[model samples]
Target: MHKEQRDGRQEQLSDILGKLFTSRGWGRKNDRLRIESAWAEAAGPELLKDTQVLVIKRGVMEVAVRNAVLMSELAQFHKRKLLTKLRAAMPGVTLTDLKFRAAAW
Candidate 1:
């Protein structure tokens, strides 16, 4: 293979990775823009500093929250908003639910 061919293939691979950076659902890289947008909107700046979203399996967001109180608060206060924002961000992202669990920090 020529250098140009190698470079072209590598560029293709990069594009694939860019797509995957959006979502790795079902162990397959698909529609990553949706996931990235969803994740970005789901958490507010204040909350995100303390929590981490580990994964989105199917339509559930596996979130690692720092404290039980905050988790409960978010459940009551932010769950709906987060899900709504997620939808706005991803459009078709599978994260219809947000599951907040105490994280091991």
Candidate 2:
């Protein structure tokens, strides 16, 4: 009811939320989502349709392409450019490299 009590409760709630987020690895999952969104933006809708981010572990992003030709093109030509764009888009996150593979879906 009092202002002091309300402030204390707010702080407690904030602390609890922080702990929950950390305990559940929400931060990493959020960063991964950001990276995926950035990749979609950088790759464009067409390219994005044929490619999907498989995982990001230890600063490396593994991407799955629909076909070998697309994978080769992405790895040989677009990898560096995509990385640069991703870094620019997500400065808070570090993406060291991208690995592309031909995947069924």
Candidate 3:
């Protein structure tokens, strides 16, 4: 209701949520909505699928497309769109390069 009451409630909720997650061994980042975008394919096919993130610290992102032709296709056409999507998902998470390579091709 009051300003001070609202502030207190917010703090209390933050503390409670922190404690609950800590007790469960779920780190704070677990609940964080990670990067979800076409660019996320670099992290792995499944990492982004399950965790909603493309946690790559390196500028180069490794994605196994299995076909050099398709990799080139994506790099040329889809690269820009994928970058845009990743930027939209994680505004401050800077990613500059996409390294599309085949694992077996």
Candidate 4:
């Protein structure tokens, strides 16, 4: 295939994938990945292992902690600071609160 033909086909495929993702609401999945990355940065490695960013809904982020003691400490002591870091890290996303819970898994 010619270079020009390959380029045209690549662009067409890109458009098709974009439309498919949009139609299936895959953008939210992308946003979730970004949020998880931001959470890792904001929470740091030591805490990252003990916590997981479950989901975000209506500006509230639900996080799963490894244990109830850690959850309590995070909810009482670190919640505000974590929220501040998260909001700063992802300015485009609305992160108003952090809810901590013991991990179901």
**Against the true structure, what is each candidate's TM-score?**
0.63, 0.78, 0.48, 0.77
Clashing pairs in 3: none
Best of the two (1, 2) by TM-score: 2
Worst 10 residues of 1 by lDDT: 1-10
**RMSD, model 4, all Cα superposed?**
5.4
lDDT of 3 by residue, 5-78 (tens): 54464345677777788998687455343533444543346434323232455754455565567668777887
Q: Which candidate, 1 or 3, would have the higher TM-score against the true structure?
A: 1
Which residues of candidate 4, in runs, are more than 4 Å off?
1-18
RMSD values for the candidates in order, in angstroms, are 6.8, 4.2, 7.3, 5.4
lDDT for every model? 0.72, 0.85, 0.56, 0.88
lDDT of 3: 0.56
Q: Where does candidate 2 have its weakest 10-residue lDDT segment? A: 1-10
lDDT of 4 by residue, 2-105 (tens): 12354464345667777889999898788878999999999999999899999999999999999999999998999999999999989988888999978866
How would the candidate models be sorted by TM-score, starting from the highest?
Answer: 2, 4, 1, 3
Candidate 1 local lDDT, 23-65, one digit each (tens) = 6563343444446545665686788777877777878877788
Task: Give the per-residue lDDT digits (tens) of candidate 2, residues 7-98.
Answer: 46434566677778999999779877887898898899989999998887889989999999999999999999999988898887778999
lDDT of 1: 0.72
Where does candidate 3 stray beyond 4 Å? 1-33, 36-55
Deviation from native of the Cα of residue 34 in model 1, angstroms: 6.4
lDDT of 4 at 95: 81
**Order of models, best lDDT first:** 4, 2, 1, 3
Best by TM-score: 2
